[model samples]
Target: MAEIALCFAAMALRGFGGVLGHSYDILVVRRQWLSEREFAEVYGIGQLVPGGNIINVAAILGDRWAGLAGATAALAGLTLPSTLIAVALLGLASKLAGEPHVASAERAVVAAAAGIVLASGLRTLRTIREAGRPRLVAARAAIAAFACAIACVPFVGLPIAVIVATPLAFLLERRAAR
Candidate 1:
């Protein structure tokens, strides 16, 4: 119970704009608490549900660890502090909205967040490379990247890209399996 609370509190402390992606990956993959596949499953389910992804993750982990009681504890640990901090920051931002220095600091934070995203991408790529299934890994990476890029364009259907790429990824994996 204490450990679960500590884990969530630590996650809450590190929570910043868009930092959850890197944090989730690190906790699920690097820490060996969950497999990449398990993380993907939980994340996918979270996306399908109503709440925020990180909060959903907390709930899922809590449920896994200690059932309903655990889930409630994890939710409280993960959300309360961050929610309070965010509300305080929002109040401060309203006061500082017209300040040039505040605006500059906000821009700096945005840039830092972008850097973190890039670093997380690189780390994921490194993990794929180290998985010892180079051919399948490379093929999936290429397909996923192409699909993602195509999905970004207006009027291009994201589902189409997934439909086209899934078979290619499967074929590549099958070949690698042999």
Candidate 2:
């Protein structure tokens, strides 16, 4: 458990811009924790499930390797530092909210985060498409629809729409296959 927590903690502290790619290589290629295909499958499921994809992945892999206790350890390790930083910075952010430089920095960070998310989606889609899965290719429309719903979160609210969209997305894919 400590090893799981420490490994995830190191991964988390490595920063976020290229974290996904780095993590994939480390866990699958280097650490031998998962195979490429298994990673792909888990990454897909993680993205489809609620909450941050990588965070979900940590829990999933941990559970697979060490059961419930491992999952808890991985999750805590992955989230703790960032969570603490966010909490610590919340007050400082509020105080500096009106400053021009702070505002610009915040905007930059937001843009980077959005880009990372968008790129992750695109990369996942491309990976799936390139995997020669005819069924998945035929169901691209369903994926697009789900993406639209996700984008509309600012209007429809989160978690609720995501929960509703998940099964509907699968249904749409089933329909699209016909």
The reply for model 2, stretches above 4 Å from the true place, is 91-95, 111-154, 157-169, 176-178
Cα lDDT for residue 153, candidate 2: 69
Residues 1-178 of candidate 2: C-alpha lDDT, one tens digit per residue: 9989988887887856545776787788889988899999999999777778899999898999899999999999888987788789898899989999999998999998899878876776665465436766756646566666776768655665566766776675577557
TM-score of each: 0.61, 0.70
Judge candidate 1 at residue 50 and give its lDDT: 60
For candidate 2, the C-alpha RMSD (Å) to the true structure equals 4.1
lDDT of 1 by residue, 51-128 (tens): 687788889988998999889888888888778888998998989989999999999989998898678657756654
lDDT of 2 at 43: 92
Cα error, residue 121 of model 1, in Å, equals 1.0
Top candidate by lDDT: 2
